[model samples]
Target: MAKIEQVLESIGAMRQGRTGRFSRGVRRGLYGIFDLTAMTAVLALVVLIYIRFYGEWVIDHRADALQAASSAVIEDRTGTAVWRASLPEGGYREVASAAEIPLLVKQAFIGTEDRRYALHEGIDYTGIVRAAAVNVRSGGTAEGGSSITQQLARNVYLTLDQTWMRKLNEASIALALERHYVKDEILTMYLNEIYMGRGQYGIKAASRRYFGTAELNRLELWQIAILAGIPKAPSAYNPVDDPERAAGRAKVVLGLMAEQGVITAAEADAAAVRAAAYEAPQQSVVDAAGTAAYAAAALREAARKTGLPEEQLRGGGYRIETGLDAAAQAALTGVFAEDAYFPPDMGGQQTEAAMVVVDHRDGEVRALAGGRNGDGAGLNRAVDMKRQPGSAFKPIIAYGPALESGRFSPDSVLPDVLQTYGGYSPRNVGGVYRGSLTMTEALTRSINSPAVWLLNQTGISQAIEFAARLGIELGSEDEHLAIALGGLHEGVSPLQLAQAYSVIANGGTFRSAHFVRSVTDAQGQEIYRFDPEAESRPAMSAWTSAALAFMLRNAVAEGTGQAARIPNRIVGGKTGTVALAMKEVSQAANRDVWFAGFTPEWTAAVWMGFDRTDSGHYLTVPGSAAAGLFSAAMGKMLAGR
Candidate 1:
């Protein structure tokens, strides 16, 4: 019995040990689970912090800054601003928000783009997660739950580059926005800031193009949907070009509206009907001609300064008066189409020409014709192409120095003969020496030997200094002896010469040359305006310029420029011809011909040359007729002025 009790005690002790072991195992398992749960909660908090603070805070501000900069625009003098582009790398304009935006249009845009806009700071993660889950199940970005603030953040500050870094930045900026501004204010800003296509930027411009009014409700739901898709691809989904694609995108917008409860299925169907009833609008031929790609290009360039998209500029409803004179434009364009002495029989290509007309009074550009009939016919030879000015540069070398030195005047006589200065020998045209011609007579005749002799008297550096002050951009590496003969290692543009001549025509005050004026953004903010920089130095004195003018007049009256003479007009001008300047050392290729001229009211220059491979031939006539085109175009283009 005692042995049995001992056995029972042993059995009971073993059972108790087993129970302790089991309890210890259970406790270990519970501790492991608690640690895991704590770690998971901490991770979730970290993710939430990133989404709430980094994604929402810092990144949102960057978006606003980039968007604000990209959305600003400069305006035309007519006050009509164009903006179809929101961002620009190499484009022309920059634009901003409308200063005079209609209040009703703002309300409509807010209602359409973000209904819960003013309530949330920026992102709504619950909605975003739901959209994400749906997106994963089906390959669609069809559901976007971003509030107006978040959308603005993405559009303005962030690039569309889908990198992990970019995603983090977007979230940070969105959160920052929530911490900073009130919801209503953000809504207003987003409505004014986002891009709508077709040079229409804001809701107001969109309303004008799609609905023909600034009021929003008047638009068919389809039109509204179409407008909504413009931010995605303005050029691709344009209704005028791809109606089917536009309609298809409209359905997607309608689907989103239904999902958001902004519209019902029944309402969406009715809106589709209203949209189908819409007939595409047609532009009047008159309006269409004036609103061409060229005008569009200029407006885009002007608009780029505003920082707004091109769409906003077209419908901004302000007059865009230009310095362009209609009569001058017509006359200048005709010159390119004028019969070319070159053959049409040479394989059916039309001769191309380019010209720029300027107002001598203030250096305002009157016209720039790129080609015949404004068709971009000629290589833009007027402004961009740089060719040797030939003898046309002689005025600066020969005439300018003479005036400044007080050693020679219009009436001062200089001996004209084959002259050697330093190691260089220069001869007059045709190598025929004419002795003792006055400054006026020498300039009219464009005598090279007399010019060289004058250089010996006055010094070449003095001539170059005069040229540089007048905006020639001539460098100091040149031999001053070359100044007498107008030989340089480089060339210049005719348009540049025209600008320089305008100063002399206007009593010697240099005005900056300009093609663009001002820019405004979608919100009507004047973002950039181009004004002439103040003159830091004088180009010349009026008395000296007047004396030079007296000499240039003799050029047309008695020299090689007699072909450019205009009856009943008091004109002053110069002619240039250089055998070496127009050819290679072998004299195989003729490079260029030039004529720079001015009347009492206008100044102009002309250059004709082959840029492909130098043509190895010279036009004895253009040195005659290039200058004549101005006299002819002047009668037609500037008849009134």
Candidate 2:
């Protein structure tokens, strides 16, 4: 009986152990199921969020996804196209259609830029994974996995930033592009929009730039391979700049083409050989007309007025109407082209000159000559390069301000003796100073002493304020008596001088000098129009302008600017010259010479000097040389009037 009771208890204990194990198994299975369900929910939420962002950010803006690339036309005052501002990077963009692209060209680009381009749906997952692994191993971005579509999206809409957000945006936009356009259209746009080397954009421009031809069908297989390799790194693989590197890149492209079965290995090898032997044609220097300078200025003004980037303005297909007087441009260019019109070259260094003409009636820039030899596309000197105005500042800073202060008149007598102020002494030209002279005589003679004395008497702050009113901004460092002789920290440009002189020509009103008169979009909608009233402001009293004009007219007629006088026109002007460094002062070498003057209809300024005024390169002539250039240019500009 006792043994049976003990066996029953052992069986009961065994059953309880089995039941506890079963309950524990059931709880473990339930926890595993719950975790799986939670992971699935989290993944679904992530996918949903991605879809929401993709739809809102990309799909809704599909119609305007691709920014149209077109060349902007710059027109003169007569509504004639004077110049065409090329796409960003500086070359024309001739957008080719799908039909214009050759099959070989397309194959080369596909093989080199995007392997499996046709099989991908806007994004190449395999490429991305491979690139990720490579980047991880390299610990940097050694490879970019962007498809052709993704590149287009980045070039057009998104900035080329390495941030994840930019990458996501690029991916989304590329997907939208693929969805909106067919494969052929996408390819065509890509070909037409990619920036090639040498300031070239699009296949057509790049072809012309590299192969001296724009016809895509005429390109050799080797040339096509070279073109295919350039979009990877434009500057690095530019054939014109570095042919050996370009040939190596082209060989890589040929190998890719052969591997992808686009061409036979033998043909690829032959093309690579031809690429290795290819030599880039020597590019011709384009002798751009003076109108190109005007167009450049107009393009800049259009960008400023419309608040658009220069690249956008250049390629937005807008029509920019400028205040360019064709006749004036012709006259200025004609004068600048003639060696006889300029002073003789000194020490084997050719003298460079710049000029700017403005219509005082509306502050419209009529003409500009940036350099000699019709090199208008080089450094723009008229509006860009600044040099000392020398005594030119007398009228705007000293005499004009003095007269405007009502404490002095054109006839007011002032001391012309050599004087020192705050350890700075100034002397007249040739170091000759009369005892005393009227304000008119002092200005006519361009005596430095009286000019500085008048500035001191009128107060430097008051003179600077008056100069600012005329659009001649002075800096804090210009607060000294030497400012009376046009000595400033940074001197003024010819455009600034012309603009300042326009105050007297306009009878005391100041107007901002501008090149763009109006701008119209491709659809013929007027986007910007110049408003004279908005830019005009009172710079001085009419009496003061009249008095100064009278004094300046005498200066041109009988003073240092006698050569600047124009017949049958009431001409007024000032002559200025900056002496060379003290070592070369005995040679009477002028570092920079200027003549800023005005007629009733136009205000103009001429500047002549070397880019660098060392002992070897300095002007041997006086300010009268620039005055003569001013007379010659202004004479033809005012011929009809």
Candidate 3:
């Protein structure tokens, strides 16, 4: 009985030991699962953090990022892209189709860079572990395990920052790309996006630059391998700089292709042999493409009107539909760019000119130009520089206000003798004023004395207020009576003057000057649009505007603005010329000449002057030069229509 008890106890002990073993195994399995769950949660949290902060940068620049293929285009009134600019990469690049990319090149890139590209979803964990191990062994950055998509994310969205945070951000963006695009699209974008040496930004551009031909399908296996290996380290393995290194990199690519079963050992050997004997040719310098003045102004105005930054507009793959009449702009630019416009007798100086033409019916800027020979964006005087308008403001300040206040008429007689207002005495051109002339005659001849008298009669504040209602920006220093004579603290731009005159032409309604008609994205989705008929602010009474227009017609017919006469169409305008009083003969005197005019169809302003402040030469001629340019430009424009 005691032996039986001992056997029972031993059996019980054995059972207990087995139960203990089973519990420990269950705990071990549970711990393993817990560890995996913890790791996954940590990864998820990291991804969430990335999405919360860094992911927005990728979204903001996604349009530019995708524009790796094409540039932003500025279109003309005909809805045709008139000018193009690649703001990010600084030049044009082509997007490659999968068929245009050689099968061998694809194989070489995939084999050498990311062997598991077809298996992983943007990030390869196995490759990451391997790279981490290698980096730990080397005590520094010994290997990069980024996939092609990850490289694209880094290239497009993120800067090359060697930080763990940047890597995390890259992984997050790569995941976003995978979610957005399919595998083939991602691969094609990557292959086309990687920047190669030389001003080239993509594989196709690099191929054209290095091979001197855009035909990539015709490249030899060795050439394909060379081009494929360049995106890894473009400068280090540039074929032109170090042919041997480039060949060495190509051999590695070939070996990887063989290992990946893309090519046989024999094929790889042949490519290797060809690479050793290959010689890289020198690259030629390519000049940057030029942008027209009207297109440049339209681009800037598009940015301003839409509140999009210029950089964003440049790379956002935007199709800016501008109001620029291409033919009109071309004619306007040609007229101002001519050397004959700046005659030797008129100062023998280098003269710069700016002009803006707006449709009187809608206030849409039809044509605009700045410098004669610049790239059109440099110093846009048409909308940037403000010069005194001289007598151009007289009609706005004196005559328009006088008519609106019912205190003056076109036939009302005013003394045109020398006049003084608070130590400021104003005179007509050459100090020769008609003794007494009607309001219409005074304005037609731009007689300054009578204009000052009219300003006193209308009250300077009322005149300035009236001008302000017409979109003329005046300052505190503009309170002086000289404002009646077009002397302001800060003068006006051609665009501003054109817009102000457009008010008179549009029957006393104010319309802000705008260049872009509509803006569309690359997908042809309308992003922003300006309806010219939306402007409804009233500047003056229609009767006053008509009275002013009638007088201006007289000016263009037989008075100071006679040079602006157009035979076919009834023209009305005001001429202004301001001479800078400097003390130097060679650098003493310069004139800012202006003509603000309109037909029933368009209101335009022309300005001519030197870019610098101290030009010694002054214009000896009357304001006829500016008026003549206006007439020529308007004639060409109307004839084209």
Candidate 4:
């Protein structure tokens, strides 16, 4: 009986302890509920205050929200964009609406980004929570919980710096965007506003840059996945620079889509195979000066004609439409690209060459080549290099001026013996001389003695006047008898050579040679126009032009310039060679050679010699080398016509 009473007492004590513990647990549960309720109320009040005040502030400034979103692109004659300028901050190309975006692309973004993007308003609370956990574990900003609208708000409305204040502003702006625009509009703005790698800003440009196509809908599933993964870390996943990382990111995007049932396992596998084989083309190495190399002369002309700085024109959102023929430029450049064109037998050591072609009818510069395989911008030899014209200068200095003098004609007799004038002696090549020859024979044979004798009779002043009329900028110190032998204080550029020859080709008319046809804004409103016809004026009489043309025609037909003869075509040309001597040097040094000519349709000039290299090394090659290149390039130019 005593043992049974002890057991009952122990059981009663245990029951009392359990009841007391249960009462304390109930109290602790109530306190926890109250704390959570208080926190929720505070969060609600803060959000309400933000929406009421900051949202109204954003709405008040809605007028300033939109920004310019187009890049200034340079177009070729055929309306093809060959180059694009840098985009301003908050700028992009044509926006693509969500509907225009491919469905596969959309699903890929949604799956890889916020899986519940459709359900979220502007911010995904679940993503934020998960990101917070991830960040806390990593001790860094390892994840961004931003939805598409949030990203758009951050890119357009707020600065890109990462900070709590910026985050708060981004959230506020994102909420406002969601209310102001529809879901599709928000997505469209986000897609276009984000920066893709390789200087591209929008989906349109990114599509064209990466895949070489602007039609995003035509992209394969793997391509769409690759693009979707790039926005997360553009530099790390840029397909052009880092293909393996891009492929890995793309695989992750595919896995996300498969998990979301957007694609099946077999489809994902097939897409993965395609993605493995995906490759972007290797970009060609462009000239260091970029498009400015090919278009430097054109840009200068634009500045001169518009009275604006070239820098201003480059940044003024203007589309420069040039009359530059791509094929002709290519053909001309290709002729000089071959090392064989400058053979060692021709004294082509360290030789550089330049050529310029103009459509004399309209003064449009058709082709301009500065150097072989050059960067195109530096020292544009065609327009910038000014060297002695050698015998090539005779047409402007001796023959044209003599014809314009009204005292000389193609048939006029001139003395070609060894002559000395004021201690200056002129002799023909190889020190040979023809006693007396007609002006036509003198020019066709490039007899130096007769050219000097004519200058003695006609005077240097008349040659200066003729060159000036032809728009060749002669130096003040160029008043000398040596001018008769293509000696000028500052020689002429290949561009000037081509332009001056145009007067002979086009019946003595002087038309300013230029490159740009017009410059317009993005809206196609013309800002500048080149009027070649209006600029045309007679530099010499028709009789002088006829006489000069007759002599020049004979040059190619039966003269030193025979190498430039294009079969089956009425071609005319002149050959020029000058022995250059530096200070303390004599005339037995390196020589500069030239060939300047014109047909009815074109006027071209070719210069070959060592300009920046050793001036002591003479070019053994004759002017014929330049003429051959000129002939070949001109042949291609005429073929395209």
Candidate 5:
């Protein structure tokens, strides 16, 4: 019995040992299989990431996609493209090569935008992790981990969406850029591709726009810091828009440079001081003669005529041919730029002025100035602003229509006394009434009562029709005797007034006032052409136009417009002044002053006033102020003719 029990125990122990050995072998085999599968999956992920980093699409389309769009060229009458239009990105970009980029500019940008730009490959995994951790802690995106190459990739190839897909794409493209281009080349492209503010792209364009120079090497360290800071938030840090904010941002950039050892602490402190004191160059990037207004107007006209959007007109590489006589435009610009040509500042606000010159022979806008000191793209007052013509409207709405009626002649006598039409009393300027005066004398003296009387006699409907024939459209609201004194519901623009006077200058023919003469596409195919004949029509009889011209010539020669007389030219003009809204304001404190005048070859309208018409901002000068400016500008234009 003992032998049998021992044998059984030994058998059970042997079976238990065999079962444990089998179980251990199966567990080891399963662990080995799981390890192999995990290793294979990781290897596949690495291979996929490598392939994405070296994307064929990114490499193939890089050159073409990165190429900047060509700017549309706006040419003057001489076919010289004096200006280049803004690109689709709302600015002008002038690409600069690595050689053109200065060392300080590069250092400033790298220090401020990407401190680890030199050390990072395309994707900064450590930075991403750090930024992600911070964002997670804050529950918001408070920091960016993108390097310079990533920014370039996003600017050139991706939208600014915060989706994971966009991030993936940006990372892939950035990796591709790093793989293909050297560090210096990538930095150069990044500098040339970034947008700084105020319709400017690239450091070169920003330099030219803000500092008034395209020479990057000449930029001060403060200016370089300004350029560096602009890319983070362009609109917020634009020096032209907000100098204090821009200086603050620039100080931060300078500090970054100091921290990076690119600049010493003392150097950074000096740059910060200069940055605080910096002012945008008053001189525009446009020619010193200031063809910016003309170029802007020409671009607008090109867009209207070609049925293309202004953006397409700007960057489609179209050639816009304008009627801008360079000499005439320069003459107008020069007159506006001169402080002496305008009234002294009132209430610490300088007077603003606009002028438009048209060639009556073809109704081409020869020259224009939108404001006293413009940077080429703001409010183009000549074409955009409409102000009361005052006495300047007498010829268009009253005298011209009266003459065409055959009921009045230059010598016809009319009363210049205070008169009322339906409780609307029209008084002569200064309330002095000449009981009766010849039509020529009334016009020459710019008597308001006679103009109202003449319009009453001509009939408001007839006068409106006649004015329209001369390219001065009046609405139903303007069907009142007050229109004779330029009191229309909607006043006329400088361009409109110039066009109306052009009919008299050209002996009764009216042609549409236009700036763009023609436009050609990138392939030089004519897309638009202004046909003067198509826009031509007889606004009045030659006899009436001649009589009116004779009277206006007399006005310029001996009457209120005497200041507009140009020697050796058959100058004809009318002086106009709109009173301020407040009756308490002195008569001399006018809201607008104008001189609409013409020579045999050219017709022009000059307007000067404050943009606002409050008592503190009213013009203290008379119409003669604009007349004198007209004389100076016209003399310059006629000199070369």
Candidate 6:
């Protein structure tokens, strides 16, 4: 009865309010101490009761199960890791270490949710007493307390079973941990064991996930304190979630750190400033593809050298060493963006184009364009799109073979009248023949009737084989004779067609085009090497190719490609037209216009057309427009460096 009275008297004293020197339960000496000892004994008895109820029945079993769960997760990398995808956002992704947390972002966590983490062994007895005293003083239970060790015990071993049994189990686990590990060690374990924000189960991961990058040994004062602040409801203070709240909490941590001499007041002030004004970063700018936006496609093609995964190549931290001369790329983008080439009508929608530069010896692709809008599509249509080579493919089948036959060199006479062979009658642009003309004259003029004459004399099979050797893959030789006018069977990709033209320019040696230079795996092991083809074929002897080259020279001199002429540099190429095969006139009659040409050191091809096949969008004219684009692309590519 006296023990109950003492408890009531202490509660009543607390009810009135007290934090200083003894102002509660005034009494005489012997009875006062006896009452104190009695209260102490009761507290011990409560601890013992909690330990007994929880210690053996629940804690021991749970600890064993948790250990097993940890073991099972030991090798499951996903469960151990945190970051999984390569995001467009700029930063390295981090994963958790042994703890199911992101290691770099988070550090040791405090059971900061508990108000009395440090002063108690596993549970806060004094806080429990004070809170009970206050609660009784007010009318009912008001506050409770838990130590770091107790919180860890609950998190690791006991589910949130609100029953007394669960509380008893938590108490036993706390006791076991306290007995097994020293107080500091128990605190350390608790710090390492708690969960933080962003799906991170530990502090380290949380730290790295939010702060960009963090290293334990190198974390700044703010970084460490920022981590310290995150253990208490990470979402509530996540900078991305609630920047203001997070900053406020972090300031509190900074204050604690300063008080503890972890950092200075000055340091905290600077960190506060940095946090308040943050700048998002752009992806690192590289210098290699400097000027040649036209070379972007070529660079993309060159990605084959790294053996990088295609996704990574297109979007990863890839440094592509393209054959693109930046000056060349920029020049093309600039010129195409001007008033010369695009249609004057809302400007040329078809002005968007593709260009490729191929090295003749072993066909190394030097440059390309997916469109006039370089890098917009991020794809090189020169290699990836199959479009007609137009009259451009004519030199390989009709002109080159006839020149090499000795029976018909450039000077040989050929009739220019429209001729019907195999139900195919080839005509001139306006159906007007120049009567008769020499082979060189015929080619210089790009006259269709004479080209048919040459093809008939050489046979379509021979012509097909000739084009095949030049890298033009014709579907059938037995088709129409109209192809002598440069009509193709199945057509060819700009890349392949570029190489075919390159073969003639490079003395008949065909280098297979390649993009990838070398490739190393994720582990940095070399996995592939591209072999540049070194052999030359008999497609045409140097003499015949040289003669054909000479004849096409007039194209830029005074012929159809006079617009493409560059002063003093000898260039040879042909123009092509996709002939508006669509309905609803895009422009006038021009379908697609193209120019595939070569210099001694560089072979470049350019194609201009509407994005779609609609006649209303393509060139209404024949080959003049493609020639203008070709001239501009080559001018830029060969300009400076």
The most accurate candidate by TM-score is: 4
Which regions of candidate 3 deviate over 4 angstroms? 1-70, 92-182, 191-291, 345-349, 522-525, 531-534, 583-589, 615-617
lDDT of 1 by residue, 1-641 (tens): 99999999999999999999999999998998998999999987887777766754454444435343332322223443322223344222223244434443344345555656555556677677877998878898866666677776776677878787776667667667667766655655565556665655555555555555545556656677776756566676656556677777667667777776667899878766665555565641122221222344455455555565555554442223334544455456656556752212212334444566667665556666654545432355566666667678877766777788887788888897776666777766556987788878787777777777777677777877777766777776665677555577666666787877776776777776544555443444655555556532367888888887877787888787877777788777776555534434444323455677888777887665444423333443446656676667765665655
TM-score for each candidate, following the candidate numbering? 0.67, 0.63, 0.66, 0.75, 0.69, 0.58
Q: What are the lDDT scores of the predictions, listed in order?
A: 0.61, 0.86, 0.80, 0.78, 0.86, 0.61
Pairs with backbone N, CA or C atoms under 3 Å apart (clashes), candidate 5: 91-199
User: In terms of TM-score, how similar is model 2 to the real structure?
Assistant: 0.63
* Candidate 5, 1-641: lDDT as tens digits: 99999999999999999999999999999989999998999987986686575454776856677766646777788886577776765668766668878899999998877777888988777787888999999999977889899999989988999897788778888888888889998998888888898877788878878887768889889999999999989999989899999999999999989988989999999999999997777755344467778888888888888889988777766888888887777777776778988888889888899999999999888888899875567898999999998999999999999999999999999987777899999877677997999999999989888899998999999999999998878898997888989998989999999999999988998989998889998666999999978989988999998999999999998899999998888899999999886877776678899999998889999999888779678888899999999999899878957
lDDT of 6 by residue, 1-641 (tens): 99999999999888656632234444455578988999999988997886866555555555543331110000011111211222232222232234343332222233234444554557777876887888889897554455667777887776866797677767777777776667655654554455655544444334545654434555555555566676666778666567677767778766655555546789878776665553322211221222233333433443545444445543332333323433454566567667567544324444457777776765555555666555534545676777666677788878877766677787888998967776777768767898899887777777888888888888778777777777776775435676776566556677777888887787766666654344333333545545654434556678877787777777767677676776556788888776665555543466567787877678877777665655335565567777777777677767643
How much is the lDDT of residue 494 in candidate 3? Answer: 91
Cα deviation of 235, candidate 4, in Å: 4.2
On residues 1-641, what C-alpha lDDT tens digit does candidate 4 reach at each position? 89999999999999999988898898888988998998899998987788556855775677355442655555556765555544444332544556669878778877886677788888899999999999999999998788887787777777888897688777777777777777766667677777777666767667777787668888888888888888999888878889888988888888888989999978888887777777885542121123445576776777787887776565455677776776777666667667777735233545788888888887888778887655564689899899989999998988888888899889999987887788989767788876888999999888899888888788788788889889886777988888888988889899999999988898888988888888886455888888866889999999998888888999999998998888678888898887755664555554688999988789999998776535445676678888887788798778836
Error of 1 at 55 (Å): 4.5
Better of 5 and 6 by lDDT: 5
Error of 5 at 500 (Å): 0.3
Models ranked on lDDT? 5, 2, 3, 4, 1, 6
User: Scored by Cα lDDT, where does model 2 land?
Assistant: 0.86
Q: Evaluate model 3: give its TM-score.
A: 0.66
Which of 3 and 6 is ahead in lDDT?
Answer: 3
